[model samples]
Target: MRLERVKEILLQQVEKGKLFHAYILEGKNCDHLAGVFANAITPYPEDIVYVEPDGLSVKDKAVMELQNRLSMKPLEGSKTVAIIKEADTLTVWAQNRLLKTLEEPLGDSVIILLSKNIENLLSTIVSRCIVFTVDEETEITDLEKEAKLQARDIGEMLLRKEKFFTITKKLAPVLSDRDRAYAFLDALQEWYHKLIMVSMGIYEDDSLESHLLTKERLFSAIDHIEEARRELNRNFNVSYSIKNMLLKLL
Candidate 1:
């Protein structure tokens, strides 16, 4: 479902007081959407339990910790929300341990699992939760349009094996503007995401770029774009990160 549609459904559920015990929010930008959903439940920060993996995987210990927390009543509100970020990274044992909670959640508690991809999760666990897949496309601003065009152009150049100097020159001006640089990175991620959807026959834009690229190549592009975004978020040098990402893409 599109993000907007998911929001609408969630709102209706909230109004009717018919919220499920568990929900699996699956898609890119899920972390952002999860925040929105969490706020909709309650404004009290103390009522929300945000869980993140200590490392690559959410260990069994973390799941046990969550289980212990949920055993107690809500600290501030009638409902206690537990948000597990990057839930796909949960280790097999952790997921298995979480299964019991999903199967029989504590009083007035909601467990929200956010994942970029849900396939990593067990089918039984997935079956126990409400699943929402985000695929929303909003109206783009002029800046975003320009950024997307630049991303497409750079992608084409990279695919054609353009010279390093040429690619760097095209990207330099974009990196110079901080706002546009972030937009460019976001557009780049979206561009590759669209390609992946097209490759999977889930999207039907039928553009030359989508037709020319394979799923593997699209995944590679998306991964590089995500890395660049993470670097920029961490205050890495903008130009350096973009250049590094472009080189990795090549």
Candidate 2:
């Protein structure tokens, strides 16, 4: 979904006085956009509270603070809007606390949870709110387009449990070209990102590829790709590091 469309939806909901108690905004630039939405609705900073992660995770304390903020009347508006950035990093305890807050409505206060990876969120919490998915808007070049196809084939090969040698041989060409290799990695990440959305019921694509993205392994697949990226960034041998990643993934 585009940011403008999301804004339109929210505006319509507000106009109808039928706005939801909570919304899960999941996608690229979601946290920034959440701020935009909150600012648009509540000019007063006090009326728009933000609950962000403390260091590495959103602890239960932050969720409690959020609940406390919403308990009060709006400082200067008809409603309050609370935003939880990087909601995917919320701790289990925090999620439980948040779940409780969701069960009890606090005035017309709204909670907007921003998540780049929606799968990390509890399904129960997701069920309680409207979810908006926004894709990254970067334009793909022709080279990148071909890289995506190549990456898709590689991913399918991995899912089919192909022999490691065959998969590595296929990856050789991509790794030989630095640009194409990076583009291929990008494509792979995008594939898992979309499939995750599909599995999570945020996006719909009932293709064979979606079938390949079985819930059993789809959840942890991105971690492998991400580790490969980190290894490459650290000047690790491309072929060796990627092969190791593939081995672990298999």
Candidate 3:
């Protein structure tokens, strides 16, 4: 289901007092799931203590904060809600620490973890949660479509790298927009990773132009790929990020 729909359901469940103690919301629509929860929490501000997992000072520190907040009666009349984003990135100790609170949550307490990949989550945590696959099936569908389209485009470009550079030059219109530029570069970086995996026989042979991204490009710039993501997070210049990554290719 779409994030909007998921949010509606969550809101309804909350109203009915049937909200799960813990939820594992999974899918590519993570941003949407967050939007739903964000919107729902608005009317009941007093009850919810939303924490952006990354912003927490210590690893799993948000859990302690959440437990502390939920320890008391929930804001006079409202129930307590905690939403953690990119939850799969959480350390093992963090999940272990949260197990007890999740298992014996107060009637007024509810926790939701939003993630793209749940395999990284502890099995104990998974078992205690009502897992929801948001875009699981949709990912395969979208990936198939994306593979076909991007493969064809990249194949033509790889054959004539010079021309492709010319095409990318046209992106000047959006080079100034940090968000769009970051997105463009991120996609390129991810595509290169998939290409490396493809070369390693991790991907289907039938996948198009699996050989387009050279192994040199893969190994030499792996560090830059990570740094680019960090740069984007820090709100660095998008055009600069893309240019630096592209330099490694040259």
Candidate 4:
């Protein structure tokens, strides 16, 4: 969903007094999105509390501290907004403790949890909150979906050791346009992210691409594609740069 659209939806809930006690926002720009949502819901600065991990993880102490602060009456707005950045970094013990807060929410208070990936969070935590997965642009996401299909087809061809001419034939449309080439690269990046998640055992994908790529290989591929994209931005020949990227991948 677009950020503005999600904001509107939440605002509607607020207007109707049907606001959810908690929300789980997961996406690449979720941190910024959460900040914007927090401000939109609670304009009063004093009523908003932002909690982030100081070290590797948010432990029991941090959750307890948040609870203590939340216990106090709001000084301004009727509702206090609490945003937990990197909620995935919360320790298992901390999540258990935080679960109590979710189960029995403070009256008229709202909690927003921001995470790049919801796979890292406990099932119970996710189940309690309304989840929203968002992208920066709905238009770009549609393009990415189309570009992603092209990428997958080419990937399958490469894995099959198809002739360069055959693969290049498949790349004709993507390489013909600079914007399409960039979108193609962006689609590969999406795959790279999934590969990382697969490596972490937090996500499952039965695609051949998942079985064919190692994290190191995927990272190197991303680097090559990004360099080619930089070249394209520098006014390099679109077809040549994209074809060169394919060569490097092969």
* TM-score of every prediction relative to native: 0.55, 0.55, 0.49, 0.55
- Top lDDT: which candidate number? 1
lDDT tens string, model 4, 1-250?
Answer: 5777766666666655556678888777777777777777778999998888879887888889989988998879888999998899999999999999988898868899989876577756765666666766747566677888988787667656688888999788887888889888767655654454455453446774344566456556666766776788789999899888888777
Q: Name the TM-score of candidate 1.
A: 0.55
Candidate 4 accuracy as lDDT: 0.75
lDDT of each: 0.77, 0.75, 0.60, 0.75
Per-residue lDDT tens digits for candidate 1, residues 1-250, read 5688778767666666667678888888887777777778777799899889887888899999999988988888888889998999999999999998977777678889999876678756765666676765866579877987998898778878999999988887786777888888767765665565455443346565434576556656665776777688788888888888989988
What is candidate 2's CA lDDT for residue 198?
Answer: 56
Instruction: Give the distance in Å from residue 70's predicted Cα in candidate 1 to where it truly belongs.
Output: 0.6
Over 4 Å off in model 4, which ranges?
Answer: 136-250
Clashes per candidate, residues 3 or more apart or on different chains: 0, 0, 0, 0
Looking at model 4, report the run of 10 residues with the lowest lDDT sum: 195-204
lDDT of 1 at 169: 87
